[model samples]
Target: MTAPSEPTDASAPSPGSPNGPGTLAWRNAVFAVFFISGLGLASWVARIPAVRDSLRLDTALVGVLIFGLSAGSVLGLVVAVRLLARFGAPRAMTISVATSSIGLVVVGAGATLLESAPVVFAGLAAVGLGMGSLDVMMNVEGAAAERAIRKTLMPLMHACFSLGTVVGALLGAAASALSVSVFWHLTAIAVLVFLIAVVAVRSIPELENTAETSAPGEPASTWRSRLRASLSVWADPGVLLIGAIVLGMTFAEGSANDWIALASVDGHGFSNTAGAIVFGVFVAAMTVGRVIGGPVIDRFGRVPVLRACAVIGVLGLLLFILAPNDFALYAGTVLWGVGASLGFPVGMSAAADDTRNSAARVSAVAMIGYFAFLVGPPVLGLLGQNWGILNALYLIVALMALAGLAAPAARERHRR
Candidate 1:
């Protein structure tokens, strides 16, 4: 198969041929592995309360400790591009995946042995950074792959991630029910992740440099210039608008993924199995949404779809918050999942579509937007601790509405 040019730019004609029907099978397989790896990570988080309780930690301490993962991810995002630039996407992704696998195993091993909170937290932090680096590089490769193939592929790929989460949660719940050690479960997942990474490594294409052409004597961008250039790309009216859209999308998703289980158990009074199921259903809905998202976005355009998703998400959050019973809780989760599914995929697509510096542009928008994920959950957890789960649900509603408001701004950027 032909490879894309180095520093792949969305606007450039790909050096490789567009992905044909013949190649889609292989591409989908690649999506499955990355998707599953992400799902496993999400599943690990869902089981944290059990791990925490096993170690006899309280809610407040758990919140502080959990923040370590997001902190590590943020750190990795800062260095992701430089690493990818030096190693190429294939090598970068492979190495990062390996890093994440090690982290996963570490968490599981610690949990199995009932490691101290400090040690567990450190392991989680390492996992977070590895996942963050892997996430950025994968998306960069994905966008390049999409451009080379001249079609939208991100949604389906991401849909796999959602699906993987759903599956992982189910597996985790089963393991939890059986009183299996968390460490053993995580180690099994790590083995699977490693195998998937080994298989996918061969399929990853090396991207070419399609960045701006400089004169023969023109000096390369200094570190200062490079930093400014990265910042300026996001400073663009179009890019900023996309960042808002992404921020909103992430808010909805991060809220749902991080807290749905907690809400089900603590707020709705469901059994732990039932609570885990709540998360599973939400992820299941999102997975379905991702699968169908690309075709819908292509047919209808990004703006209208995003607006609809936001409205639906708000309605779902309200339903979730107001629900007096488990039936309503499940229904609300379905709504939230459906509404959230499109945001990340579509937002990333918009960023790629609008900017010439596709990789950096996508990265910048993500860097800004994902802070919502890092910040939103802990704040919500604190708020839940302070007020109650019901009140915290209201905050989720507000964030989703804010996300919806930014949709039009993103569209306007495209028009310009």
Candidate 2:
């Protein structure tokens, strides 16, 4: 396999320059990947209720099943870097997208045909593995695309993901209302998204070819050496700190992904359709926040912006859990969405502050952030089983507060 190329600096070729088409193509490509990833993941999330009912599962069983996705994601992280090294980001993305699409098909089949919880869990694991690798590749591509544009575009790229989620959630709601079979809904959506992704990936520039300049006579790092280097990044204090901050942020976000809809139905008395709408509202709010976050981060800096977001998240969660009326619940969902928007993307940008080791550092942060999903499903399951789904969300409030305290770790270090 060919050695991975180094990433170019942000100053290399601004997309606004006369030679803009190439840079713009890459940016659009990354956005497409982000959108597809979000859509596929949310499509599955929207069906969680249907799947649970089909399998006759309780809250605890639902949580255990969701753990399959998390476990797959963790495993994906281990394999993705190597794939990126051998095949490049675009190719790796193609492979991952295909994997997720197939996994979704399997999940749908299991739900509709077999009604087997284990089969569904296996499918979710497959989806998670693909999603995990896709997450890393897309972020790596987004960072490279941001550099090419010479702008703070991470939030915008993430916003595309939220936009996709909105679309997926709405579609999922429609599917549920129509009583569409899980197999048909997901399989059809997967096919449509896979086609779009195929077209989008064609535009990704060869990012691996732009490696940093090396000293005279220094050999390019082999795959084994690259793997070793990636593992070593975990030891860096800054990276670890960034990872910790992101852990809280991801926990907040992932919890919503897995639980918000269920909470609305179980805690509040909404039907599945209404529950999905609430989830959609949350994603829409996140989309708005991410759409507007770029300028805020550029002007105020990542640390301050993230801190404010954490505070808003805490307020949102409290209101969501304690609100006495549906109106207040809806209001809290909006606050929660907006508040949770910036953390993951900003943390990614912070981890990639030094472009030379961006791919590896990003891998490290993503692994840490994803751990939340790994632990979230089962933990929240038990909590919900004992207390209540809405009450279980209070755990995220504490996490958001911790995220605020860790915000300073994301400050860009000034090299003398």
Candidate 3:
């Protein structure tokens, strides 16, 4: 069955909806896949220190290695639409998860057994490719499911991702504490991800006429055509504004991921353990925000919630950057996490609101948001080198303000 051609009644999805009688199961399946995706990525990340030590790599080499992952992700996004065109949603999703899981295994083996940088780089690239494609596919599926049921579920779906990250990170820490090798640690994660992928793909509803990339009585669309369509979305003012929100909010979230601990240690005169705790607080707050954001949005509507989040996020950031006391610092961390929580998910949901071009729009917004991971790190690294890490964060404040101004763009656009 295809997705809903128009919005269903608010009470329940119509029997003809893609959800059908299995809506609950499908929603849970989507949740499972999102959780596994997060778990898979974090499991690899959590063992990065081990990979570095095993390979005897320096910081510069590590940076180059990560660049491989980022480059691969860009390549994956470039091909995502084509993948969907060729395989349809179910098979395409399987391919994506299989690619990422296999790459993860290769990463573990290369790091621990082969002790080879080139091999690990190849693995990381594979992981990135599979995951990048998987992200688009999953989000499309998620947006479809949420819309069918007339619910705001993206935040909770993202919350599952956050929960996965927490689980993976904690497991990795446990492995490290117990002297588990990178090979074993990541191999286990990869195997589980593969198993989950196998089960999850069976549940995603196939799109026959939905997503509007294919028209009836037409031959199959080519990758080139999909690529053109994806590129064309860049011209859409609404999509672009949503992308701006993703850009800013994603940068806020990414900045904390990369630097919160360092800032706490260097900028705030905290011990390494204390710095780690601060970073944990930020992550916890983010998870909390996502867990609660759906219900909050349901009550307040997207624009008001988004605007409030932007304001809270900026305030939290300011406190983290300029506050004079511990209370302000803790408050800022929580506020920052909560504030940054909904932007990416909400933008994605907004982009998919007009489902005729849902896949293309999602791909466009995702790539734009993904830019944060690619560029934010290096840019902030340079700025922090000269200006101090805490000072470098003010750039996020500006971006967050931009997101606030653009909140109206995410106001639900009824399907045309």
Candidate 4:
């Protein structure tokens, strides 16, 4: 590799530098942006009763409207390759934050202006699309930033996401208690998120210019070239398997995020507040797990960490399935959180290790994983409607098992 470029001030992280605290604090803040924005959909979730009462929608119809974010996300991931190639990291990051900020504004606005189901779906789609774009770019830059600092940073970055979720959950509760209109609350949060984006924009480096044999001022990938590159990444067997493993983990995580409260209420007979607390425990455990993930990944190999996480998740889900009361419910959620924490970050790192085409490869694997997230919860909802939420959880266990088994194969494929 060419000698590392002269340490440009934009890229350096100095201990005594005056900008140091801001940089370090913003690193965590950026992760929070990912986590909080992710759970932004959930922000209004607690307020759903208020919305339904205001809009006069029955439960069945309300269910269909929930698909906005996932649909937008899947669509965004499908096109993320071309998006990143065209805009590069800095501009791409800016656009995603800007778009998501708008999404937040719309979501808050929808609470007041859009009473019809279709209008609600439109608002959700905007959030999802913005989130989808933001997710890919953050991870892409996250991986690059970790490398520039010469350390294992993905886990900690993701841990901040978990931390952000915790904060978002609290923020939602506070907003609800204050009787803050969802519109005003989210709009305020969006402004904060936007300012955070602006401050961190400088810290995000350009993509590493991975073009091969550039023929005299070759341009970035157009749609055709981006498609070819995406195809090449997907064609790799290791990438394919890693994608599968991620699919399972994401499916499990999505179920927890989207369905766990409903399950606690409908299946386990907990109060709404109690059910929310159960979900909170799960997220908290995940945050703890991720905070410590960097050391775990550094000490042991990726496969071992992943396999262990899967096994724990399986146990966590089974515990929930078989347990008799609220105590078991909380414990199970905690176990699930701890178990599920490392899958995404470790999986992304593994994907990165597997392919030299880092951007395309990461995007390819993320596409499948996120696609599972889009499809998994709805399918589970269908099962819940048919056989009840308890039976639906069996699928989560099965998926976790698949993740555990894929670890060895994925790691071997990446072995040089």
Question: Which candidate gets the maximum TM-score versus the true structure?
Answer: 2
* lDDT, residue 214, candidate 1: 22
lDDT (C-alpha, whole model) for all candidates: 0.70, 0.81, 0.75, 0.66
Error of 2 at 36 (Å): 0.9
lDDT of 2 at 109: 92
The true-structure Cα RMSD of candidate 1 reads 4.3
* Residues forming the 10-long window of minimal summed lDDT in candidate 1: 1-10
Candidate 1 — which pairs collide?
5-207, 5-208, 6-207, 6-208, 6-209, 7-208, 7-209, 19-149, 108-183
Better of 3 and 4 by TM-score: 4
lDDT of candidate 3 over 1-416, digit per residue (tens): 00111121222232245546666667777898888887887677666656766887654466567666777777776677678768887788788888988898899899989999999999989988987777766766776778667777766777777877667666766776677888888889988988987887776667653333442222465878767766878889999999899899988987776567557766788654455456657777878888888778778889999899999999999999986977888889889988998898788778878765666777678777888766775577667767877898999999999999999999975422
- For model 1, state the Cα shift of residue 273 in Å: 1.7
Off by over 4 Å in 3: 1-21, 49-62, 113-117, 144-152, 205-239, 258-280, 318-332, 352-363, 384-391, 411-416
- Which prediction has the highest lDDT against the true structure? 2
Off by over 4 Å in 4: 1-42, 45-63, 78-92, 112-114, 177-181, 202-229, 232-236, 356-360, 412-416
- Candidate 4 — what's its lDDT? 0.66
Q: Is candidate 2 or candidate 4 better by lDDT?
A: 2
- Worst-scoring 10-residue span by lDDT in model 3: 1-10
**lDDT per residue, candidate 4, 1-416, as tens digits?**
00011111123333223345544543554465566554555565544444545566544444555567678777665455466678766677677777767877776677656655576667767767766767756765554455444566666666666766666656665665577877787788778777877776665545444212121222454667756766887678888888878888888877787777667767887755565566667777888988887788768877888898998899899888778876877788888988888787667766666334655666677777777777775687677777787888899899889989888755635353
Assess every candidate by TM-score.
0.87, 0.88, 0.77, 0.80
Query: Any residue pairs clashing in model 4, and if so which?
Result: none
The worst-scoring run of ten residues by lDDT in candidate 4 lies at 1-10
C-alpha-based local distance difference test score of model 3: 0.75
